[model samples]
Target: MHVPDGFLDAPTSVATGVVAAAGVGIALRRARAELDDRTAPMAGLVAAFVFAGQMINFPVGAGTSGHLLGGALAAVLVGPWTGALCISVVLLVQSLFMADGGLTALGTNITLMGLVGVVVGYAVFRLVLVVLPRKLGSVPVAAALGALVSVPAAATVFTLLFAIGGTADVSVGKVLAAMVGWHVVIGIGEAVVTGLVVSAVIASRPDLVHGARGLARRTALRTGEVAA
Candidate 1:
C-alpha cells in the first residue's frame, strides 16, 4: 500500500511525515530493549526477506499490484518493536534506492505499512493465540490469521487517510470497497506464506519465534511427560 506523491495533498503528506517520525523515533528506542545478539542478525535477515518478498508483486484487479507487507511475519520472527523498525527500514530502502515509493511520501508508507500494520497484526495474532488452545501448532495459525487481517486493515486505514486528504475526487465508499476487496485476496496469500514459515520455524527452532514461546513450553511439557 505505497501511496505515491501527489496522491495525498501537501499538508496531509507533511502531517503524516511528522507522525511517522514520532512513531519511528519511539520504535527505535523500544527496539533497544527488544534487540539482542540473536535477534540483531535475524533482524537484518528479516529485512532482506521482506525486501525480496515485496519484489514478487501480484496483480490486483485495477491493474495495480500488491506484495507482502511482512509486518506479521517480522513480528513473529523477531519482536513487534523490531518488526516495526525492520519494515520501516525496508520501506526507506525501497523509497531511496528502488524509487518504488516517493521520497516525500516515505513517512506515509512507514505509517501504513510499518507502524499500523505491525501494531494491528501483532495484536491480532496475540489475541488469536490467547483464545485458541495453547498447542504448539496454534502459534503458526495465529500468525497466519494476523498476516491475513493486517493487509485489509492497512488498506482500510489508507482509505480513511485518502478520504481525509486524497487529491483524487473518488468517492470514499468506492475507495473503501476497492481497497478492502483487493486486500482480501492479498491476505489469503499472506496467511499461507506466514503460516508455512512460522510453522517451519517452530519445528526447527521454536526459540527463535517470538510468538511461539507458549508453543515451546507446551512441547517441552509433552516431551517431559513421554520421558517420565
Candidate 2:
C-alpha cells in the first residue's frame, strides 16, 4: 500500500527512511548476483510490468483503493533481492514523478512493499514448493499462493506500524480487521498476477527466472537449496 504523507509521525517516518535506505543499499549489493544479460532485460520488464499494474487500482472498501504489490511476482521471476530493488525503484519513480505516494512516506512504503512483501512472500513460496510436488506447474501455483498470502501479511505489517506511530487514534482491532479483510480480496489479484508472470517467465526462458532456474532438467523440480 502507498502510504500517504502525514500518515506517520516525523520520527517514525525518519526511522523508516533510514531502514529503507539500508535495505536498498543491501539489495543493490546482492542484486548483482542475480542480474545477467538475460535477467537484466527480464528485470526491466518486470519493473515496467509492476509499474503499469500498479496504475490500475482496484476498490478495496467503500472508497479506498489498493494496487498490486508485485513483490512476490518480481521475486519469483527475478530474485528476492533484485525483486525488492525493482519494486523499490517503481515506488521511488511513482512517488517522485507521479506523486502517487507521499514523499515523506517513501521509506515506509519501501519497507512495507519492497522488503516485507518480497521477503515474506518469497519465504511462503519456497516453503510451499518444498511441501508440494516440485513440478513446473507447481512453481506458478506456489507463486500464486505466496502472492495471495503476502498481501494480508503486508496489511498486517501496516496495521502494526499504524498502532505504533499512527497519527489518528483508530481502534487497533478495527484497523487490523479492516486492513486484513480488504487485503484478502486484494491478494486474489496478487495471486493471479504472480501466477501469470511466473508462468510466462518459466515458459519462455526458465533459465532467466531465478526461482525456476533451480529446477532439475528432468522433472523441472529443484535439486537443491529449495529454490530460494
Candidate 3:
C-alpha cells in the first residue's frame, strides 16, 4: 500500500524515513554480492515487472490500496539484498514521477514495501523451502507461500505504524481488521502470480533464480548461461 502524505505525523514520518534510509543503505552495500552478469539484468526485469504489477490496486482500509507486491517474486528470482534495492528504486520512481505515493511518505512506502515486504517474504520463502522438498519445483511453491504471507505482513506493519503515527485517531483494532482482511485476499492473488512467474523462470533458467541456487544444477546453469 502506498501511503499518502500527511497520513502520519512529522515524527513518525521522520522515524520511518530514517529506517528506510538505513535499510536502503545496507542493501546498496550488500546487493553487490548478489549482483552479477546474469542476476544484474534480472534485477532490472524484476523492477519493471513489479512497477507494472503495482499499478493494479484493490482498495484496502484507510484510503490505502493493496496490489500485487512482487516482494516474494523478486526475492525468489533475485537475492533478497538485490530484491530490496529493486523495490526501493521502484518506490522512489513511483513517488517522484508517478505521484502514486506521496513524496513526503516515500520513506514510509519504502519501509513498508521495500524493507518489510522483501525481508519478510524472503525469510518466509527460505523457511518454506526448508520444510518442502529441496527440488527446483519446490522453489515456486515456496515463493507462492511467501507471497501469500508477505502482503498481510506488510499490512500488519502498516497498521502498527498507523497506530503509532496516524493523523486521525482511528481505532487500531478496526484498522487492523480491515487492512489484514483485504490484504489476505490480495495475498492469494499474489501467491498465484508469484507461482506462475517463478515457475516460468524455473522452467527456463532455474540457475538464475536465486532461491533455487543449491537445488538448480550448477552444470546445467553453465550450459544455460545466456550472454548478458
Candidate 4:
C-alpha cells in the first residue's frame, strides 16, 4: 500500500526518510556485488515489472487498495540489495510522475516496501529453501512463502508507525486489524504471482533466477535414487 501524505506526523515522516535514505545508500554499494554483465540487465527488467504490477491494485477494506509489493518476486529474481534498489526506483517514479504515491511519504513507502519488504521476504525465502528439498522447483515454493509473509510484515510495521504518529484519530487496534487482515488476502495473490514467475524462470533458465543460483533439479537414477 502506498501511504498518502499527512497520514503521519512530520517527525515520523522525517524519521522514515532517514531510514529509507540509509537503506538505499547501503543497497547502492552492496548491489554492485550482486550484479554483473550477465545479471545486471535483469535489474532494470525487474524494476519495470514491479512498477507495472503495482499499478494494478485490488480493492481492500477501508477504501484502500493492495497490489503486488514485488519485494519477494524481485529478491528471488535478482539479489536482495538490487531488489531494494529496484523497488526504490519504482516508488520514486510513481511518487513524482504518476502521482500514485505521495511525494512527502516517499520515504515511508520506500522503508515499508523496499527495505522491510525485501529484507523480510528474502530472509523468509532463504529459510524456506533451507527446509524444503534442495531443488530448483523448491525455489518457487520458497518465493511463494516469502511473498506471503512479506506483505503482512510490512503492513504491521506501517501500523506501528501510524500508532506512534498517526495524524488521524483512528484506533490502533482497528488499523492493525484491518491492515493485517486485508493484507493476508493480498499476500495470497502475491504468493501465487511470485510462485508462477519463479517457476517460469526456473523452467527456462534457473541460472537467471537469483534464488535458484545453487539449486538444482533432481532426477531419479536407474537405481531409483535421486541425483542432482
Candidate 5:
C-alpha cells in the first residue's frame, strides 16, 4: 500500500529513507548482472505494467481498497534485484507525477513495497519452486503462492513500523489484525493477477521470465540430447 504523509513521524520516515536508498543502491549494482539485451526491454514493460496495475484498486472491505503490490510479479518476470529497482521506479514516478504516495513517506513506501515486498516475494517463489516440480506449469503456481504470502508479510512489516512511529493513537493489535485481514483478501487478487501474467509470459516468452530460466535451460538441453 502507498502510505501517505503524517502516518509516521519524521524520524521513522528518515530512517526508512536511508534504508530505501541503500537498498536501491545495492539493487542498481546487482541489476546489471541480471539485465541483458533480451530482458532489459522487458524490465521497462514490467514497470509500466505494474504502474498501470496499481492504478485500479479493488475494494477489499471496510472502505479500504487494495491494489496489486507487483513485487512477486516483477521478481518472477524479471530478476529479484531488477524487480526491486523496477518497483522503486514505479513508486518514484507515482509519488512525483501522480502524487499517489506521499513525498515525505516515499521512503517508507519504497522500503515496504519495493524492498521488503520483492525480497520476500522472490524468496518465497524460489522456495516454492524448489519443492514443486521444475516445469513450466509450476512457475505460475509458485508465483501465485508467492504473491499471496507477500502482501500479508508487507502489511505485517508496515504494522510493526506504525507501532513504532505511528502519529495517531491506535491499537497496534487492532491495526495488525485489520491490516492483515484485508490484505489476505487483497493477496487473492494479487495471486490471480500474478499467476495469469506469469503463465502468459511462460507460454509465449519463457526466456524472459527469470524464475523459469533454469527450467528453460534444462528443457533446451533435453531437446538437444534427444535430437542427438
Candidate 6:
C-alpha cells in the first residue's frame, strides 16, 4: 500500500526510513550475485512490469484501494534480494515522479511493500516448495501461495504500524479487520497474476527465472535440451 504523508508520526517514519536504507544497502550487495547477463535484463523487465501492474488499483471497499504488491512475483522471477531492490526502485520512481506515495512516507512504503513484502513472500514460497511436489510445475503453485499470503501479511504489519503511530485514533481491531479482509481479496488477485506470469516464464524461458533455475537445470540434464 502506498502510504501518504501524515499517516505515521515523524519518529515512526524516520525509523522506517532507517530500516529501508539498511535493507536497500544489504540488497544492493546481494543482488550482484543474483544478476548476470541472462538475468539482468529480465530483472529490468520485471521492474517495469511491476511498475505497470501497480498502476491499476482495484477498489477494495470503504474507499480503500489495493494493487499488485509484486514482491512474490519479483522474487519468483528474480532472487529475493534483487526483488527487494527492484521494488525499492519502483517505489523511489513512483514517489519522485508520479507522486503515488508521498515523499516523506517513501521509507514507510519501502519497508512495508519492498522489505517486508519481499522477505515474507520469498520465505513462504520456499516453505511451500518444501511441502509440494518438487517439479517445475510446483514452482508456480508455490509462488502463487506466497503471493497470496504476502499481501495480507504486509497489511497486518501496516495496521500494527498505524496502531503505533497513526495520526488519528482508530480502533486497532477494526483497522486490522478491514485491512486484512480487503488485502486477502487483493492477495487472490496477486496469486493469480503471480502464478500466470511464473508459469509463462517457466514455459518460455525457465533459464531466466531465478526460482526455476534448479528445475531448469534438471530438465536440461534429463532432456538434453539447451535453453536458447
Number of the top lDDT candidate? 5
TM-score of each: 0.91, 0.91, 0.93, 0.92, 0.94, 0.94
Candidate 2's C-alpha runs over 4 A off are 59-65, 216-228
Query: Which pairs clash in model 4?
Result: none
Residue by residue across 1-228, what tens digits does model 3's lDDT show? 889998998899999999999999999999999999878998999999999988887664567566788888888889998998888989999988998888889999899989888999999999999999868889899999999999999999999999999999889999999889989988988898899999998888777888998898863557576433
| TM-score of decoy 5 | 0.94
Global lDDT scores for all candidate models: 0.87, 0.88, 0.89, 0.90, 0.92, 0.91
| Tens-place lDDT digits, model 6, residues 114-166 | 99899999999999999988689999999999999999999999998999999
lDDT of 5 by residue, 1-228 (tens): 899999999999999999999999999999999998768999999999999999989887777788999999999999999999999999999999998899999999999999988988899999999999868899999999999999999999999999999999999999999889988999999999999999998876776789998788866566556656
Q: Pairing residues by index, what is the TM-score of model 4?
A: 0.92
Query: Total clashes, candidate 3?
Result: 0
Off by over 4 Å in 3: 58-66, 225-228
Hey, what RMSD does candidate 5 come out at? 3.0
Better candidate by lDDT, 4 or 6: 6
Q: Residue 94, candidate 5: how far off, in angstroms?
A: 0.5
90-136, model 4: which lDDT tens digit per residue? Answer: 99999999987788899999999999999999999999999999777
Candidate 2 vs candidate 3, TM-score winner: 3
Which pairs, if any, clash in model 1? none
Best first by lDDT, ranked: 5, 6, 4, 3, 2, 1
Model 4 stretches astray by more than 4 angstroms: 59-65, 216-228
Superposed by TM-score, candidate 4 places the C-alpha of residue 62 at a distance from the truth, in angstroms, of 9.3
Candidate 4, position 39, lDDT: 83
Per-residue alpha-carbon lDDT of candidate 2 for residues 62-85, written as tens digits (9 for 90 to 100): 887777899999898889999999
